[model samples]
Target: MRNAEVARQLGVPPGTVSYWLHLDRSRRGECPGRRPPPPCPRCDDTPLDEAAYAYLLGLYLGDGHIIQHSRHRVPSLMITCSEKWPGLIDEAERAMRAVFPQNRTCRVRKTGALNVKVYSKHLWCLFPQHGEGRKHERHIALEPWQQAIVDRYPWGFIRGLIHSDGCRTTNWTTRIVAGERKRYEYPRYFFTNKSDDIRRLLTDTLDKVGVEWRVTRRGNDPYNVSVARREAVALMDRFIGPKL
Candidate 1:
């Protein structure tokens, strides 16, 4: 289908209809002599380690992209982390290496950010989460084995979610104490994501850890999960920690 046809059918802009059409051209019964390309040299057959993979999967769902390489390109995995938290990027690199030790990992510089990228065809295992438009437009759920991994290392999963889509910071508000006006500050953790499934996963995991969180909307935007209050934040502090 053409870009304009897709845009009209899906009620989306033309630019949003990128790559799919371009890539599908190869699979549209194009030529009688065409053959599947040889396997990628960078691809690996590494076994999955549940705990580490759960953490990496959480990070991928939040900030990673598994690019499907074109006929002339190589498949690659990319995870973007904030430049402010070098540790988060380092852990991300570590997770990728742990998952795919045979592959080489590198960093790409983006404005105010750095991306951990690896060229490996094996990264296609994450294709389930890849889609058109944005994550909010797509539904994300864990596979049975992936969910089992998360069940064991829920905290690690939470860490990745908060590290990628959530933040820890101080929130201040003015209130009245004993009939007198006063101001106070508190440490809180806020997580925002367009995916309802991701939010539910975070909340369910938090519930398991006995850390309380609240859900609200920021204007007309996506759901915001708040781990405020001293008690709740304390629990998060012990388990989630800072992005670093």
Candidate 2:
């Protein structure tokens, strides 16, 4: 890593880290009676906005993952989004940057999807969702502070969930009434996930957001949350808007 990257990871000024790096071991002296410096800065030391953290956490739970290993490769946090929706990938990068400022981040180019990844040991501590198998095979719960953040910014958290595992689309249909056929088109927001707890968490937040959502089915999973009513769609659009 470069001086600026080290400074960012250490939460120190670039010049300070530079000064230390420029000095040779023979010339660099330590103060007496002072303890040795830490092996590395804590990942939690990276500053975080509660809402942003919660949103990233939601995305992590929905479609992101962490890889842990003792050798072969560095552990990393990775989130992949469809190539069709580059905006979501951009948002995920921003969110990851904000939360894991000290980690070395990268983007992987693929044929059908965009992947954002960061390497850090402290990331697992920040989010304990790492477990065996898929999320549905395990339980997803929130810490007290995370719950508080979600309570304050339910829409932001919901946005992350929707962007990761959900989608926005237009629905067109025709109905015949009184021998008259009426054609109409409407926009709807839908989220599908296999984790019952995640679906429940999303619905509970929607309840708090005052946006009514209905449970629906999709081929991916039987658990789904959808917003199709005119008013509900309007409300969801207020927060999530369109996926660019």
Candidate 3:
């Protein structure tokens, strides 16, 4: 059967059939270029937007994934964004396009969120942290080069993480002011991730940016990093405010 026919009948992407055929051909020593790889900063020395990359990196580590089929040459980078935050979805797509200006991006709806994805052969090159298993199951650490970018754009990086796995909330209490009872509101930031390494990365960046944070134990896992200090919350507000 023709590959396109098979793909159409099976409701699979045409590229999937092509990838399987290509793999069979390679076993017989026939090698052909399926698709030319897109330009990559690490491979082709293409200029990268350091700030955008820093932000995207944070998103990837928090709620993004690079999916590469074992038999396919092209891989897709997917960032899951909640439906409640339409602005965040747009920002995620924009950051991806900024990082790979020549590539096209798309959104796939799933459950209550959208998967903003872009396909390229160079995703692994750009995100070396891509590997088997969930991010929390593995040791997630940035390369020295990536760390430099984040250091240069700490706010962008923090914003990305906040957009994905963190949130800004208002905490309120009653206070007496001038002999009158008044409601006082405190704005705080919280970043929750199961991976200790990922949490450390956030805290480390927060420290670099002079944003004070403390680890708050939520349930059995101490997965919450809270920024409640007046100065720290103000800093977060300036750099990485509520998810709009």
Candidate 4:
């Protein structure tokens, strides 16, 4: 049937029906004019930057999402970065490009954040955690292969998480020293996520790296992982620093 007919019957836009038909033909190798998709690291054994992949994975768990619309030919990997930190947007784009060098990436401004996205059919293969419903509502676990990559580049993963949903802030208090009031400040790191599994990933990696962290409650929900120990904060400062 024609796309218009299908669109009318299904109550969808004609363009959507056309896109679906085009995607079906392309998948069957019937669309000779379509550009062939680039090789995938998971399926084609292509070389991948494990460190970058680890970092991208962290950002994904924290603030990233993949869209696979039935009417779209390819899925999009999107990581929402705050416009307040333009540098993070660039870094997120770099990470996406590094993970999929052959694909092009684009940024769409939305309210106060920029959605950094790249289109590729292999996004699901790279990010196996993509699924139905919100990430926090679903069971999230890393496959063995992804775990191996994170294990090798734990700091990179932590940095990615920090850049996405974590922050470095200073806490200050007043103290009496030699009959004079003195102000003292200490810096700490906080990683906040709604998903329990995502928070566990951060703390687990922190443990492997010998960085002490404690779970903190936001109101009634324990949704924050705090790294406030002097030694741990120093360690995090040395590696992750503040998001630019």
Candidate 5:
């Protein structure tokens, strides 16, 4: 099948299918316009034949899952905190393949970090049946309060409730942009939520910034909403109108 057709059927981009095919072709020693058979059955320590590998690779390319074994097939050689090694990745892949012939198809990739200095010396096998690349989700914009939480924590913060109510009307307003521009209906709403002790930290920080906020129930009931909460909702309606 053509790359685009295969990608459309598999729900991925055509470039991804082409990349995988290129990787497969590279592994078969057919990169410079040479046609070679599929990779060997035991090429990467997988207990499957060439046909099985082809079928499994197809399934993997088509969004199939790769099962991981509970135990490591070959024990990893642990190297201590020795600073003598520079090209550890190349050295490790060579040593591993010498010890286990099937590891020839495996590629050594780097990951993880140390205290101040980064550490990288992990080896992973690239089986044709299980080498599909990863997918990444796009970053999304966060609400004002969520942005506040992210700014304070740099990791993440939780929100129990967010109340936003606003009204829309057809009106023209002029504003100075690069020159001058007109805008339609504007949005006027407020956001508030309950959190644990961590929220108390956020609340104290937000108070200094004139955010007009308060905390009802703290750590007692994380998800529980009390009668006082309804009063807060009513207050929001009074301050920020009745349409949301």
Candidate 6:
């Protein structure tokens, strides 16, 4: 049966089915396209054929939590394999179609990082802009560590540079340690107050990477890319000492 039909029968979103199918793909030695056969749902451990597996993956890709926003629903397909498997992606696509004939718009992209592939669609939202003269909302107070990142890294590296009206909270602390998962948000301490924790983390990571940086508080305006670039060059000169 197609993914939608299976999802309707199962009383779940098509995307959820897709996620399970994807997980099943990982369990098997095969990439995505080479599904075994549909096992009995009652049995749980029964193998799945290519058609059955594709339907499940379609359900997952459609309903997975990987994307933050719910309005933008797009399916994706990723395939990895050993040897020069140039046909793997194609085979997977065909198999998926056998289950969900309606899913023709999902996008797939290949990355050079190992044998990984990513399938996703963009989600768009409408939000306000932040700048002078605009009514600004107070962002969450930054922890010491987050502040450190802002003080150390150049502004250009920070992702979310624009200001916008919204809620703020301490939950953002994770960004400094790992980084933001979303596309628009800054690294850490962009809108929030500076913290010592951020500074130490920034310094440590930069040190490990062999990049030298400095902190300067010129004004309330956070790190600006052009200004930071100029400052970085000067800092490098100071570090190496005057050239003889």
Q: Estimated TM-score per prediction?
A: 0.76, 0.78, 0.82, 0.86, 0.18, 0.21
lDDT of each residue in 48-127, candidate 4, tens digit only: 98988988998998899998789997889899999889888888999998999999999998999999999998888999
In the range 158-230, model 6's lDDT, one tens digit per residue, is: 2112111001122222223356454332221112224333233334444553454555453964321221233
The number of clashing residue pairs in each candidate reads 0, 0, 0, 0, 2, 34
Local accuracy by lDDT, each model: 0.79, 0.80, 0.91, 0.92, 0.34, 0.34
lDDT (Cα, tens digit) per residue for candidate 2, span 1-244: 8889988999999999867765544244454454433123233253566677777888887889988777734578888888888788888888887776655678988778877888865765677778879899888888776788899989889998998888899999999999999998999998989899999889999999889888887765578788999999998988898788
lDDT of 1 by residue, 1-244 (tens): 7889989999998877876665575566454576544333224333565676778877887888777646636778788998999999999999888776666899999999998998765555544566666787878877675677788999889988888888998878999889998988889999988899889888988898788889878998658999887898998888777777
Q: Which parts of model 3 are misplaced by more than 4 Å?
A: 1-35, 70-72, 175-183
Displacement of the residue 63 alpha carbon in candidate 4, Å: 0.8
Error of 2 at 179 (Å): 2.1
Which pairs of residues collide in candidate 5?
A: 166-243, 166-244
Ranking by TM-score: 4, 3, 2, 1, 6, 5
lDDT of 3 at 65: 91
How does model 3 fare in lDDT? 0.91
- Against the true structure, candidate 4 has what lDDT? 0.92
Instruction: Kindly give the stretch of ten consecutive residues in candidate 5 with the minimal lDDT sum.
Output: 157-166
Give the per-residue lDDT of model 5 (tens digit) for 119-220: 111222322222334311222223353344335432112111111101222334677787868564443223223223223433443344334454334466
lDDT comparing candidate 5 with the true structure: 0.34
Q: Candidate 2: misplaced stretches above 4 Å?
A: 1-46, 70-74, 219-221
Q: How far is candidate 2 from the true structure (C-alpha RMSD, Å)?
A: 10.1
Q: Which candidate is the best by TM-score?
A: 4
